[model samples]
Target: MKGKNIFQEKETHKYDDIIHLPHHVSTKHPQMALSDRAAQFSPFAALTGHEDSIRETARRTEAFLELDEDKKEQLDEKMHVLQEYFSEKPEIMVTYFVPDEKKAGGAYVTHRGRIRKIDTYLRRLLFEDGTEVHMQYIFEMDGEIFGDTE
Candidate 1:
């Protein structure tokens, strides 16, 4: 009565008789489990695969780099030095680019391992753990074995 509005001024309780009555139980069906009941209000994905497509589109990758003649020569010199010290089993860090399987470009990854072998014929650097890094993919190499060799 203190805050009665025009719409409610003349209105009476339409369900006043049933307003205080307890809620009726459904005898036709048993009570639903809490998990299943909560799932009913959970969000539904109307567009299937839409999120995956967006994620794939938003995924980023790097382009493969091409080293200039001088840089390439320098890398080759470093490789030669590595090959010479291969028998000594030197510990070195090699940075190389890996092409993406699903994209046009990829990324550069660095690996630190002992020198197992430098297969010139196969054009790959083999590690003690049987990891084979392609020579062409190598960006730079550094270790104590390459001391003062530049």
Candidate 2:
């Protein structure tokens, strides 16, 4: 609604323009209805090629990230990791295997970026390049809990 008052004896409400958010895909027109459903996923989309150890690390990260700062501090001695990426809108985010392990031929590294996604049972991250990473696996790794995985 381009801020128009549609109470002029009209049964149908008149719209002007649509304001689109990052997640919103509607290019609303003054006289049109634009609806979009573009679901975003993480840049780090799958665990298909990652080593078991590195994957485990990702899993731990996923789990700890789900916790609030207080709850995270309670469980994680290295609260700094949590603090780095914890916020209403994550100031930092988790990146898996930069430069790509397949090409780099080394352990895929996990680190924090400047943007983060909302945490949930199965959350996904959206990167600057529209890359998406799944955090749910971070909660699924079954191994000895260790210091923030790298």
Candidate 3:
């Protein structure tokens, strides 16, 4: 029994003296709002727009296609053929490259519409619906109107 009492004395924690005391409150500064306190522990992003930058970098774009001399000649011939049928307003499909405003590369877009006019000054094919495809950007032209030309 005496040995047990000695063991209990040795086990007495150092904090036992102040453990029952009241919690200290700051008098200099006012108590923080619950929301403000919670905000301190909330997750914070140090790098703003970092995720957007990464997404822009990862976004894919295609390089513009350059036509060979023979291909360019074929396209010119097709344009002439289109001009010949301009009165009929033939429907055609044209694939062209649209440059990306933000990046170096671009994308190919295929558009189908009736030809309104071939603007020689602008070097573009104008559609009846007001869509225009630049001559230099044109990759391919196809339509049932040019069946014999093929």
Clashes per candidate, residues 3 or more apart or on different chains: 0, 10, 0
TM for candidate 2 is 0.23
| Candidate 2 per-residue C-alpha lDDT over 1-150 given as tens digits, one digit per residue, 9 for 90 to 100 | 676667763534333233342444556744333332223332453776567757655542211234466643433442234444446333343434333333322223454444444344455555445555554322221112223453
Task: State the C-alpha lDDT per candidate.
Answer: 0.88, 0.40, 0.91
Number of the top lDDT candidate: 3
lDDT of 1: 0.88
Q: How does residue 80 of candidate 2 score in lDDT?
A: 38
How do the residues 1-150 of candidate 3 rate in per-residue lDDT, one tens digit apiece? 654677566678757888899988999999999999999999988999999999999999999978899999888889888988889999999999999999998999999999889899989999989998999999999997678777
What is the descending lDDT order? Answer: 3, 1, 2
Look at candidate 2 and tell me the lDDT of residue 139.
24
Pairwise lDDT winner, candidates 2 and 3: 3
lDDT: worst 10-residue window of model 1: 6-15
